[model samples]
Target: MNSSRGVLELPPVVGRFVDGVGTFLADDVDEGRPIRCRFLWSAITPTSCRWEQAFSTYGGRGWETNWVMEFTRTGRDCTNNG
Candidate 1:
């Protein structure tokens, strides 16, 4: 998403940072069926990072990657107003 918005479905549930990987787990419903959601984020470099969103229908036993994105910072100065 190239925007910021509020998502109550994904509450602020912090996960313990281990081995440079940060994860967030939450429960969600899909098509009236219960499912597990996981958001994984890891740093690939100082200016780049990888993020993925996966879902587990097998009671958190296995996860299937549903979405993924690589964020690489551009050369433009984002902090500048000019």
Candidate 2:
């Protein structure tokens, strides 16, 4: 599996709160293939956010939704760093 981490920067849309996307790659060790995973997310509040992720094999099939996650920001520093 790929162990490296990557960052994606997306320009803010006119009315959106999301700043970017995050991507992670992993190998399907059992199938001896590589898989691509992506996160599409946005901050909903100073203390919370929502996101969805998808996965697919390279050049194989279309992406499938793996999960949707929503969580509260744990700390007080929920400032925009971008």
Candidate 3:
């Protein structure tokens, strides 16, 4: 993830990813406080997608979105690795 600050390095998140949607969860410490983090990914198109990060105070309940990112193709074809 990239922000005005810089790239972000997230901890090891574990979850399931199926089709064009994915949900990842992890436990992290923010500002010396323990919290639960969630990262969701959704595919909009072959060349576009959406990603967001949220925080939960109690497990998976009551989530507050902290960041969101949208990605689009930049004229770089990735259909073929050749």
* Residues 1-82 of candidate 3: C-alpha lDDT, one tens digit per residue: 4476698958799988788689999998776778899999997687799999999877778899999999998886668853
**Residue-level lDDT tens digits of model 2 in 1-82:** 2335555533222223335444443334225556555556665677777787666775436788879999896775547753
Model 2 score (lDDT): 0.56
* Model 3 TM-score, 2 decimals: 0.73
Predictions in order: lDDT:
0.81, 0.56, 0.86
The C-alpha RMSD of each candidate to the native structure, in angstroms, is 4.1, 8.8, 4.7
In model 2, where is the ten-residue run with the lowest total lDDT? 9-18
Candidate 1 structure lDDT = 0.81
Residue 38 local lDDT, model 3? 94
Per-model TM-score, in order, reads 0.77, 0.43, 0.73
Q: What is the lDDT of residue 81 in candidate 2?
A: 53
Q: What stretches of model 1 exceed 4 Å from their correct place? A: 1-12
lDDT of 1 by residue, 18-80 (tens): 798888888877877888888888886888999999989997899999999999988788788
Which 10 consecutive residues of model 1 have the lowest summed lDDT? 1-10
